[model samples]
Target: MTTPDKPLIMLVGMGDLSARVLTLLLGHDATSRVVLAGRDAETARRRGNLALFTAANLGRHADIRSVGLDLRNVAATAETLARVRPDIIFMGASLQSWRVITQLPKPVFDELDEAQLGPWLPMHLTLNHLLMRAVRDSGTGARVVNAAFPDAVGPVLDKVGLAPTVGIGNVANIVPALTHGAAHLLGAPVEEVELRLVAQHYFSHYVPRFGDAGEGAYHLDVRVAGAPAAVDHHRLFAQLDNRLKRLGGIDGQLLTASSAVRVLHGMAADSGVRAHTPAPGGLPGGYPVRIRRDGAELDLPEGLTVERAVRINEDCQRADGIERIDDDATVHFTERESAVMNRLLGYDCTSVKLGDCPHWADELARKYGEFAARFDT
Candidate 1:
């Protein structure tokens, strides 16, 4: 139950990312009441108990509970939302995990990697679409933080006025690398370094692997001790690629969970806080945002107008396999990505209509599963 003193937070998935976020929230003593909701009631209960036990051992206390929620059933989910009436909702559920692609053989994985993350949009978009509709129907004004492929998912949902308040991870995962690299370059403390970055998900992966933004368009401005500083972008990125150690697979989710905690705290604080996040106000990609009690808004760098920043991300979205999101929330895929999906899974989807997301998601999952099974041996 929510009270005036402490806010209620709802974690909508019992996956690794959500579990990590729950632990961090409890460890930070950020909230009093947290409801872990998912499809599997037993899993949710076990995860909730583990979180509670971990927090208790760490000398932290919170009201942790669990509930079974099938997001595909909008009415039921809405009923749950109306009953819980949380202050904030962090949605991490999806039809399929992004890591499913990694399960393929290395050669196959490399081939599909060229398609980028956009071809897998159906898996990430469907649940978020359902959840947002539930939120609207339930008449809850809870601020939503979507963890699904927000760089593209956020914009697609925004076409129908169902966009999340903001999104976590993605571009946010790049900020820390930039901050550390800049601090080392300037010989300054990390706390004294501030940066405003306008980017999308592509650069987050590309910069770390290739030591450059590649074809992705982005803007970065670094300030040391509150003053604009001149730093070498090439050198900074190279160091990030060469010197920084980034965990791969599930372990890397810690960076994303930390980003969500920061945004959650900012949203609850009266004075608000500034942080880098993806899909603020359902924009094309990520930007520095000012998160307040009410919501989040883009805090773009000086001289960078909203139009220019959006254009930059819009252009980069193509490199990520998304051609564009139509005004009606239909998502179009690049020719290469469409062909790749057809070749690999025999699941052809050049475009997807918002209303047909559930059908497409199911088909994609089934086809991909069969495809992966053939190579399992």
Candidate 2:
């Protein structure tokens, strides 16, 4: 049912979250043609066919297929992208998920917390860097939506001129959850509640639990029925406790997927529109963005300049243990994060040069696997 004029969306991961996104896309009016690409072509094909079957069962027809995509091989990836020339690309590829990393004991987690979650930035950046290069070389104006650690990775990629169009999750996820809480508190319909959040990725992890997020600077603006509505942060955040949707290995993929779909929908729409996303065009962190058919534009709330917004998010990165992302795309980890990595995993990487990301990713994956296994038994 796909026509030549319709858009082609390429999804470059088939992990737990990616698969859920595929299913969710197929269940709705996903008019675009989707190519599910991964390192395992056969596995991707199997998942693609399953998605098609599910679509058929739901009385929907989907233009879905699969292909092999090894992001490490830039030449091959470029050749593939040049041939397909997809309109949009959604990258969900990572060696590991944050869920696995969150399974450590509280004391151990807190120790690692001092360094924060910044040590894992390389794992999230490796494949995405190469994929962006492939897009650039292919000469295709493909809008990319990164689903990795965009809170930090987006700026790193942007520094090297390989920034994705926008980042998924983070603020995108938080805004909706906050909106739902705001709507419940106001006794208004969810759609009637307009929520804007200027924050970073770190807040999503603990906000739903303790509600004390982002070093005590969680910026949020709420309005109901086109009228200003004052929100009691204490009361509003108290409702978030019941919405703790992730536990250990399990995650709230449904929320992440729904938010991502909105970004994609905005991409395919004719005119530009606004949505909350993390790291739009590789800016420091999450911001409200005006997504267009071609790309996205930063739509930061009124009175917030680009520098101030970037400064706020950049300062927030320390909570995740990333000291700074230099002009050359080099990422310097905080001393605490480096020491904890060395002591716990016998691995040491204080700074990561962007070009050296491939090697770092391979080593970090092995080390993280070993670290996670220690807790399994």
Full-model lDDT for every candidate? 0.88, 0.80
- Quote the RMSD, in angstroms, for model 1: 1.4
- lDDT tens digits by residue: candidate 1, 281-328: 899889998887666778887899999999999988888889999999
If scored against the real structure, what TM-score would every candidate get? Answer: 0.96, 0.92
- Measured by lDDT, the strongest candidate is 1
Superposing all C-alpha atoms, what RMSD in Å does each candidate have to the true structure? 1.4, 2.4
lDDT of 2 by residue, 1-377 (tens): 32434678899989988887787776556434799999999999999999899889889888887889999899999999888888889999986677665578877776665556789888888888889999999988888989988888889988878899888887787776788888888899999998767787766665775665746344677888878799888777766777533432355777888778777877765346678888887887788787777666887656778888888788777766788999999999988768988888777999999989878878988887787787776
CA lDDT, candidate 1, residue 264: 78
Clashes of each: 0, 0
